[model samples]
Target: MNWLLVVVGGMTGAPLRYLTDRAVQSRHDSVFPWGTFAVNITGCLILGALTGAALAGATGSHLQLLLGTGLCGALTTYSTFSYETLRLAETGARFYALANVAASVAAGLGAAFLGVMLARAVWG
Candidate 1:
């Protein structure tokens, strides 16, 4: 079932996101929320790839539900990104906060585009 696939993917994605955040954050010494940013970008890339694959007829609804709707949905967190940006601004890290927004948006879009290109190249 679609719901079951989503659940399974979410179950994997949520924990993977947590572990990935912890691992990445542990290595960084800033409050710029590198973990959240990384995860969001990664999610965007994967989602784009999945969408590309679907468009190329390389994937189906079940895969979309599991990887795109389920995995990416759980892996990325807009709330965390928003909160971190606000926190940075409130704490006088205004430059980093603005940079985060700009960089996240730009890089996320670029990554997604790249993902789509890659998927099309590979699948189409």
Candidate 2:
């Protein structure tokens, strides 16, 4: 049952990530990996909210396994982020690479914190 939940979430999240990435990338001409950045931050925010709900006893382990471990695990792509950053650096876009790293980290963390706060406030 747990595994099925995870699988279902992963199935949804993986394609969602891909479709969203393509859509976002298509809309932008920049090479800053905005697609990957978007998904990762979004994932962080969602996971944070889910975690907050769990902490507040509004959710349980099954939801956690499905959304956090499965969905977010697929929705976020650390590998793609690393590859894009490394590609930027190798291609002489070191500024973009550094900016991507800094922005992604800062924004991801910020989104997560904000999500948690929002969830706690709502759930509490």
Candidate 3:
């Protein structure tokens, strides 16, 4: 049952990630990988909310396995982030590379924290 949930979550998350990436990338015209950044931050927010719900006893392992492990795991792409950073540096967009790292980390963390706080307020 747990595995099934994870599989279903992954199946949903993967395409969502790809479609979301494409949609975001299409809207932007820059070397910066906005798509990956957006998805990663979104995933962090979702996972954080799930964690807060779990902490508040509003969620259980099944939800964790489905959304946290499967959905978030598929939705966020650390590998793409790393690759884009490297590509930017190699292509002489070193500033963008550093900025991407800085912004992604800062925004992702902030989003996750905010999500947790929001969920705790709602569920706790």
Candidate 4:
């Protein structure tokens, strides 16, 4: 069941992430990976929101199991980030790998902070 949850969540999350990336990249200059940064940041925000909601008793364990363990587990792709960074480094794109790390971390933190603020505003 847990495996199933992850798989289902991954099926949805991966494509959603891809589409989001493509859309952002298309809308803007392709000089930077705005799409990847946005998705990862948003993923972090949702994870934080889920944690807040669960901790506040606003939702049940099953819901957490779905949203956090399933959705968030799929949404945040540390492996992808790592692999991409490594691949870039291997290919001599050291700058890109560094940018990926910096962007992911900064954006993810910003998103999580925003999510917490939004949750407090709405739910507090």
Candidate 5:
């Protein structure tokens, strides 16, 4: 079932997100939310690839549900991104907050576009 697929993917994705975040954060001592940014950008790239595969008729509803809806949904944390940005602003790191927004959006979009391009080239 679609729900089961989502659950299974989420089971894998959520912990991966956490571990990845921890790993990335451990490498950085700055207030910039590099961990969250990495995960979101990565998620966007993967989702874009999955979507491109679907569009190319290389994937099914079940794969979409499992990867796009579940894995990406859990891996990308918009709430955390928002919260961290807000915290940065509230804590007087306004420049970092703005930079985070700008960088994340730009990079995320670029990554998604690249993913789609890669998928289309490979599958189509």
Candidate 6:
């Protein structure tokens, strides 16, 4: 059952990752990987909200199974981030790669924190 949820979440998450990549890529002019940035930030916010909801005792395991295991699991992507970073490294774009690594983690975490705070304040 849990494996099934993971698979379903992956399905949604992978496509979301791809769609967001395309959407951001279409609007950005730099090779700085705005798609990745957008997706990770959004994912962070969502995960944070989920965490907040879980903590508040406002939800149940089935909800967690869907949101935590499915939605969030799909939303937060590590593989694409790794692949892009590696591509940058292999292409002699060391600085850009490092920036992506730092920015993704820092911004993602920041967004997650903000989301948690926002949900807590608003919903509670």
Per-prediction TM-score, please?
0.97, 0.98, 0.98, 0.77, 0.98, 0.86
Query: Candidate 4: TM-score?
Result: 0.77
Worst 10 residues of 5 by lDDT: 47-56
lDDT of 6 by residue, 15-76 (tens): 88888889998998877778987888898888788778777777777767776778777776
Question: How well does candidate 6 score on lDDT at residue 37?
Answer: 79
Off by over 4 Å in 1: none
Clashes of 5: 0
- Residue 112 accuracy (lDDT) in model 2: 94
**lDDT at position 37, candidate 4:** 68
Task: Write out the backbone clash pairs for model 1.
Answer: none
Q: What's the CA error at residue 124 for candidate 6, in Å?
A: 2.9
- By summed lDDT, the worst window of 10 consecutive residues in model 6 runs over 58-67
Pairs that collide in candidate 6 are: none
Q: What lDDT is reached at residue 40 by model 4?
A: 79
lDDT of 5 by residue, 5-101 (tens): 9998898889989999999999999999999999999998998899889889999999999999889988999999999999999999999999999
Each model's lDDT: 0.93, 0.95, 0.94, 0.75, 0.94, 0.82
Q: What lDDT score goes with residue 95 in model 4?
A: 88
* TM-score result, candidate 5: 0.98
Write down the TM-score for model 3. 0.98
Give the 10-residue window scoring lowest on summed lDDT in candidate 3: 4-13
Report how far residue 97 has shifted in candidate 5, in Å.
0.2
Task: State the displacement of the C-alpha of residue 50, model 6, in Å, after optimal TM-score superposition.
Answer: 0.7
TM-score of decoy 1: 0.97
- The residue-by-residue lDDT of candidate 3 on 1-124, one tens digit each, is 8999899889988999999999999999898999999999999999989989999999999999999999998999999999999999999999999999999999999989988998999998
With candidate 4 superimposed using the best TM-score fit, by how many Å does residue 34's alpha carbon deviate from the native? 3.6
